[model samples]
Target: MPKLKIEDLARIREQARRATLLREGAGRVKITVHLGTCGIAAGGRNIMTAVLREIEERNLHDVLVTTSGCAGLCSREPMMTVEVLGQPPVKYVDLTEGKVKEIFAEHIVGGKIADRYALAVGSERVM
Candidate 1:
């Protein structure tokens, strides 16, 4: 591996800071991509890439993107959950790159749930 450069370190530092902020719930929106084995087989990686691309293209700093394992809906592989502050979380299913972009634009940025793609809203009850 090549020696790490100052610029690379700065970039890494910025990424860590952003992650810290997300963990502390500082962002207005949080997008969690489901990346389980089934999800990966169904293109979850593409969905994640699409979400990140949308954020970068929009120059958005208030959106947090993370990944999780299976959501217990294997049939809904390539799923993602979008949680906007002050609103219930919405889980979208069977996602593709185009659908992910649409969800980012309409749900993540516009603050409107993309109902057509959404499988459900709100979280499951915990014991």
Candidate 2:
């Protein structure tokens, strides 16, 4: 394996710092990806990776990507929650890599709340 370059390390550190700064700001979007065993088994890692890549690709310093334990929705593994500023939080279920990309593009970036794949929005709200 190749050694990690200083610049690459620095960029990663920058991104991590940027993630924190973005989370602290007034205007930002928070994305929570479920990374429990079930979620991981269902490609949560891919979703997480895609989320980070999309933020970098779009220069979206305002989107914060993070992970959490399972919510006991194994059937809906690879679940993700999107909380855009001043908007309701949306939980999307049954995600695949392709769907993750589409979410990043259409909903995360384009500001369109995708209803087709959504499982829930908040407490006791399912779609």
Candidate 3:
């Protein structure tokens, strides 16, 4: 294979920098995929893959993707929470790859919540 030129290295560096920024909370949106034991048993891995695929396909530099433990709802395993800056986070449950794609397009890209797949919008108030 031919050696990479300085320009190629620069482009790679920029891409890495943008990814770091997203992970550092500089992103406009954050998606947390629940991957607890229960979640995995319910196909959380697939959900995670779908999320990543969507981000890659769309080349979304402003979207951060992460994984988390259960959301205290085992039955709702394989779930995810989407948080858009300046708006409340929305929890979506019982997902499939197809559903994830739709959510990414409608909610993440279009700024509209996917109500059909959403479990709730925002967290419960603390006592």
Candidate 4:
């Protein structure tokens, strides 16, 4: 066990606060990363890391990021879904760190759907 320090405690508390806010924040948009076995093997962990990094770097306070088991598209392994409160969720596929950042900037922050990387819009498939 690590000896507790004041800085460590503060960091832990901040992380907890952020996690709580992300889970309970009202009207927050949600971003879900699929982490099934196939997805993980196909770089889901990297996708998740990229997402977290973007959130931290951009200081996104009203967005909830989470992970799901699978979307039943193993071939599309590393995928993510972004859902604004009243909008149909958009599913992005074949993700890389670069694409994730573009999605974050264009879709999440700028409110424009990035049509190129998106695999599905709501119930209709795009690619």
Candidate 5:
């Protein structure tokens, strides 16, 4: 078995806590990345990493990141959504690392929506 270091334990705890937050989804903002077969092929992981890094670097502890299956929009496989307590959950299509950073700075931190990539959730059509 591999040895578990203190840092590993802390990361484990943090991930567990994040999972719980996604399941609850009541008081916090949850960011879910659709990672189905198509999603991964479309740079989903890159977008995910960028978003996570941005959140961590900016110290946005209220946000939780989760993963979901493909949204059935392969053309927009790298799909994501940002849900806040009092706002409608909005999805973003065709995510890229650069767009993730822009979303973080312009929307997440600036309280503005990124219309360029904003897609409607729970719909077959892309916005």
Candidate 6:
């Protein structure tokens, strides 16, 4: 490999700074998608894609979308946990592409939980 240039280092630093702002900025909403073996097998990846598309379509810069392993609920694969500041996390399960869009609109954008598709509301059962 060739020696690194100062311009390259500067570009990398700027990229890192932007990424940090995107993930750690104030008043940001965090969405975590479960992507363990079972989750993936149940279409977690498609759910994640739908979420990202929704965020982009809405031009939302204050939402941080991330993924994690299973929450030990294999039966509830393709699940996602949404966390907004000053609000208890809501876990939505059994996702499809269309359901993800609905969740994004109602829960993420409209400030109301999509109780229909949600498996739990702050640890209590919904379905």
> CA lDDT, every prediction?
0.88, 0.83, 0.92, 0.89, 0.81, 0.86
The sequence of per-residue lDDT tens digits that candidate 2 reaches over residues 1-127 is 6789999899889978866776465446889999999999988999898888777788877787779989788998889999888888899999887787788788888899888888877755469
Clashing pairs in 1: none
Locate the minimum summed-lDDT window of 10 residues in model 3.
Answer: 18-27
- Model 2 backbone overlap count: 0
Q: Give the per-residue lDDT of model 4 (tens digit) for 1-127.
A: 8999999999999878776875565646789999999889999999999998999899887888789988988898799999988899999999999999999999999999999999888955669
State which candidate, 5 or 6, has the greater lDDT: 6
The list of candidate 2 runs beyond 4 A from truth reads: 1-20, 23-27, 124-127
Q: Which stretches of candidate 3 lie over 4 Å from their true place?
A: 1-16
Cα lDDT for residue 121, candidate 6: 69
What tens-digit string does per-residue lDDT give for candidate 6 at 5-52? Answer: 999899989767655767455645889999999999999999989988
Give the candidate number with the greatest lDDT: 3
CA error at residue 71 for candidate 2, angstroms: 1.5
RMSD (Cα, Å) for all candidates, in order, is: 5.4, 6.7, 2.7, 5.9, 6.6, 6.2
Q: List the residue pairs that clash in candidate 2.
A: none
Question: Which one wins by TM-score: 5 or 6?
Answer: 6
Model 4 misplacement above 4 A: 1-19, 23-27, 124-127
Residue-by-residue lDDT tens digits, candidate 5, 19-68: 56546655457788888989999889888899889987886768878899
Q: Pick the candidate with the highest TM-score.
A: 3
Clashes found in each candidate (C-alpha, N, C closer than 3 A): 0, 0, 0, 0, 1, 0
Model 5 spans with C-alpha error above 4 angstroms: 1-27, 121-127
Error of 2 at 81 (Å): 0.5
Ranking by lDDT: 3, 4, 1, 6, 2, 5
